[model samples]
Target: MEENATDGLPLAGVTVVELCHSVAGPYAGSILADLGADVIKVEAPGTGDYARDWGPPFAHGTSTLFHVLNHNKRGLALDLRDRVTCERLLGFILDHADVVLQNMRPGAIDKLGLGAAALRARKPALITCDLGAYGRSGPLKDRPGYDPLMQAHGGIMSVTGIEGGEPVRVGVSIVDQGAGMWAAMGILAALNKRHVTGQGSHVSTSLFETAIAWMSPHIGGYLSGGAMRRPLGSGVTEIVPHQAFPTSDGYIMVAAGNDNLFRALCGAIGHDFAADARFATNSNRVENRRTLIPLLEDIFRVHASAEWQSRLDAAGVPAAPIENVAQVLASPQTAALGILQQAPDLDLTLAGLPLEFDGVRPRYRHSAPALGQHNDLLSEPIAPEKAAS
Candidate 1:
């Protein structure tokens, strides 16, 4: 198949070498690849990225997680522990790469002699991104990191789930993906700098730091202002009428961010009690949430979710029926937005990038490669004279 014209893709000429495993590092590489970077993912010699095994819902017996995070990239396996092979691989990447991404435990890359200092020495303009569980300088720098553990440690668990239930990890690998996005942003920023100064610098982020940054609003509220947040279970703690309420057919989420919207919500539902002097203000509504919510639920329960949605929309108040993943995927809005696409000749579908440029969006140009699928590319003979040169 012909490569589509990449007229609007931002990183068309960039090349990235991803020596990483699992979601975080590879995810960043995938984003860059989506934006038109040539991302070559270096995997382990045999087992490959560990995410390859993290699935029950596999496509062609490959991990869905791996496929989702690794599209539009090539894979080459190398035995980084083998000094000669490692050196050769590094040499190849240093010769042409613009970015190097790795998620090894703190000292692993250094041990393999591909540390940032060494790579920088070889190619001064090559950006190096090091992602880890805890960053490079802290006491826990050497410790291995994973998303779930970081969620627990970074207080994400504290703000999730029902108030009386067990502290719950997010249903997704949010910490890992957050770290990936942060790392990507840093890499792009460094790239911008490199364009001006012709120098590359180390970019580092950790799962813990990512989670903490994601939780900053709640953390700041609790730590600096003495405002504690409780797990309200699908509800915003300080916002009344922002929780999922039962409708005749199903649950519907409603948000009333201000007085007019609250009034519109009350008017739309024909609930005069919502406008009572006792519940007139947002603060009062929040204070009396136990009373207001049940009343709203009672009113909402009299109508189907669809009816409530129409009524709320007509009132210019924001509302929607609560939807599961299947429902969300099947939503007309999702289809209209072209949020999902299928890979050619593959039984898999994946999300497209959220933004468009010059009326063009990123397309999935290739399926995720199988383990060591591009071994020839890595293992091809380089004559000794070429190697010496």
Candidate 2:
């Protein structure tokens, strides 16, 4: 493929019909849009996507979340139960759309006659993705799911907080976003398969599946039916010296993944603990972590976080001060990366896709649309007979 053939957009001629809401489904549409697909978001009549109102932090009178998750797409509002609208959407899919993505409750799309089976039967070339709450086929297939619920049920929260502390949420919607990314990846693979076999595929993922995937390491290790260990909080179970330590001022995260970094870290802190029998190797350190952690803490608290960070950096030890959100956004690295962007109609700065095309990050060609902003696409009234011909 020529670089200029797509006018620099990888998915230039692809069309996506997004039958979705909230964070996960719309985020998948945004991912496609970022790659240059023409994404048309189908929302409910009147109120639109629920996430549009999910805020005290509104931007331009709507939830900033809507702005954050939905960029570079069109919008249309219609109730599928309305036969005319359903047929129009179906007709649009049969005739024009290359991809259709939905995150509705299980069986809801099928009830509306727009499920993968129905749509694929009509347009065998259409790539379809379903983002289910739970998985598509399980005893809990019909169960409604969310990020926090998956975190709890899939054991993420069980291994998240301090050993005796209350279970804590991961502070981000990992399950939803993870499933969305999985859906997008599946769609891309389906598109590739279609290119060769001339047939589409049904790609599906769930928040539950994503949540369990996040526990692969911990859960895999416990396959022998051992009891779940208490949470270590900001530390990895298999690695030692990999947690935040309090300094005289703030805190610094120190990671000595191997023996070399461990030795260097010990040297920088002026500790001969690397020579001590109990802490001679990484495995030995893990076995004696309870004893070693306190000794390291005592040494760390003698210096301020910044001073320790400087020393660790000079010694080539992996270390950094724990930065808050504000500090992170303001850091020089963030500015250099230039992942933030703005479109003309958008009133606020937003983060763009974290990918570069030909060394330039793709800018938002359009901000999130208002409700039914592009309803004119269906103004001519859809005709299925004409599409099939």
Best by TM-score: 2
lDDT tens string, model 1, 38-79? Answer: 788899977888999998788888988888999888778888
Kindly report which residue pairs in candidate 2 clash with one another: none
- Please give each candidate's TM-score: 0.93, 0.94
Candidate 1 is scored at a TM of 0.93
Against the true structure, candidate 1 has what lDDT? 0.83
On a 0 to 100 scale, what is the lDDT of residue 167 in model 2?
Answer: 79
User: On a 0 to 100 scale, what is the lDDT of residue 288 in model 1?
Assistant: 84
Off by over 4 Å in 1: 1-7, 379-389
Every model: Cα RMSD to truth: 3.8, 4.2
